[model samples]
Target: MLSSWLLVACGPSQEPPENSSLTLLHPNNPSSDTETYQTENDFDLLVSDYESTQRVIWQKPDLVIAQLGDLSGKTVADIGAGTGYFAFRLVPRAERVIAIDIDQRFINFMDSIKVRLPENVQDRFETRLGKPEDPLLKPSEADVVMLVNTYCFLENRIQYLKTLATGMKNEGELLIIDFKKNNLPVGPPTELKVSTAQVKAELEQAGFKVKKTDNQSLDYQYIIVATLQKPTNKIN
Candidate 1:
């Protein structure tokens, strides 16, 4: 049964109302409540929602991670890594996992979980507090970058992607998964979502080439795979 707080959180919360539209949850999923994100005070509830088993049925995390292929020597950055849902999971697979987010509460939450990782893999995880305008990734630092359920909320998405592209290695890949713009049984209201077409176009505008678009995988989301374009040599 969903907790009482979960029921109460289905609607937007009081504080940080600006983030009310950032939730990627289905109403059935306890974490689907957007209220938990309104403030750092609800960290505990937010964790429960993010890590809930119900989310796995719809999130299909393993399949999503599979898209990154073998991460033997790759450094993957998970943007908006609330509660390290994908970050901690990638720790054992990738050479390194940088969990980036704008909220310090989520950052601290991930740090708390980091202490419990197996001794060897513990070092593989790092949490970074990012700014609203920038993710603060170093030049060519990531082999693959991911933004799950956090793309639509971006204010200046094109500019953000341009800055994000600078952080990827040459020929690096980017994986984006977000709720489809539809009246789905779960997820935020349809009007608040971004369509796959818009995402693809923005990726192109930001210097990436769309490699694949998968719309049938998740029940309510679409996956976009794009690669950074290589700089062409110009004759002087």
Candidate 2:
């Protein structure tokens, strides 16, 4: 159930003890302001059709890669990595590309795709089935974790991040790319769209230090790069 919680987000009243173990909380449903993820046909259309305005003008997948320079030997966790869109492109440069999605079908599809690739290329990629709150990442492992058009799908946003932080390296970067709230011709309904400022605040509240904000990179969406606050110090 999405209601299951493994950890809680940081706050003046919700601050977790330093020795606490990680937790992931999943709400019974998505937030009222947001729409749910696509099922059957919608999922097919979304992943197969990449020629939409979001891709051509925005050049989204490529644009994100270009901004994060020199991914060689780095580990990238592509959260909500549907159809292995960014995961396939990242494997060549990244030492390990972990493609995470809540959908088993997506993971199955990526697995089938990998079966046809050369042996060397197959070794660089992996697919993980992630839950709404828990991505099931190994603690202190990834170098970079990115979510493209995936942030808003989360129901318990802040608490989810707290658990996600456990899966990353101290200096790891967290990237988020999502639609702007300006009534774009396409994308999730305006009411479901989260503003960049709101996104930044949520991340900061969850202990991420916002490093860069680029609103011009995409015509419809903006990108924010924030590093997880090290435990004094601090995953998927």
Candidate 3:
């Protein structure tokens, strides 16, 4: 079992009202809930609202997809896939896409939307109910696992990465996209924001090698591509 101590970052807690559309779930403290600024029952609503308001501040999905190069026939996992937006995009590019989220409500929402997806791409997308600390993907299964705008909510960063690593095949890649701490007002609370260096350090400590880091069009976020390095041979 992975240790809980590996989780890092903490934030204020607030109870979400029954009718509240948005709820923030933190991985470090699973029992606590936080109310978000917006209220939207469906993840698509949140995505659409963000895109509309932050058109200049949001990263272009197509550009990000381009950075990933050729993914055809590759199995990818979208961790913390709140609305399956990224997963849907990956469906046509990747051989398979496992969209995982911790919230049952969100999973239900994904399932509901899955019905409307084109028949040809529908078979490539799969949904899974996941936990904050564990993504629930099978060991050595995915060629790539992506955490987009969602890594800050995690408490046990190392454990979470380890769990993800377990599900990744050798040489698998992990792509992380999150807001930069200095780019205030664009993401969560300032204190809860994570810097690229911080993310790189945490991932490195979790046994991943930083392959590339690039600034994203989003006002204060970056995209990092990291890969697990093979162990070096040791002298007997």
Top candidate (lDDT): 1
4 in model 2: Cα distance from truth in Å? 32
- Candidate 2: regions farther than 4 A off: 1-42, 50-54, 233-236
Candidate 3 residues lying further than 4 Å off, grouped into runs, are 1-57, 230-236
Write model 1 residue lDDT over 67-183, tens digit each, in one string: 999999999999989888899889889999999998888888899889987878878899999987799999999999999978876778999999998889989999999888887
Sorted on TM-score, best first, the list reads 1, 2, 3
lDDT of 3 at 162: 82
Q: What's the TM-score of every candidate structure?
A: 0.83, 0.79, 0.78
Over 163-201, each residue of candidate 3 has an lDDT whose tens digit, in order, gives 789899889999998878773534555567788889999
Candidate 2 all-Cα RMSD: 12.7
Q: Residue-wise lDDT of candidate 2 within 1-236, one digit each (tens)?
A: 11101111111123333432221111222432222221222444334333233344454577788777888888899998877777898988888999998878778989999999999889889999998888889988789998887787786888898889999989799989887888664455577678999999999989999999999977778999999867772242
Which residue pairs of candidate 3 clash?
Answer: 7-155, 7-156, 7-157, 8-155
On TM-score, the stronger of 1 and 3 is 1
TM-score of 2: 0.79
Candidate 3 TM-score, true structure as reference: 0.78
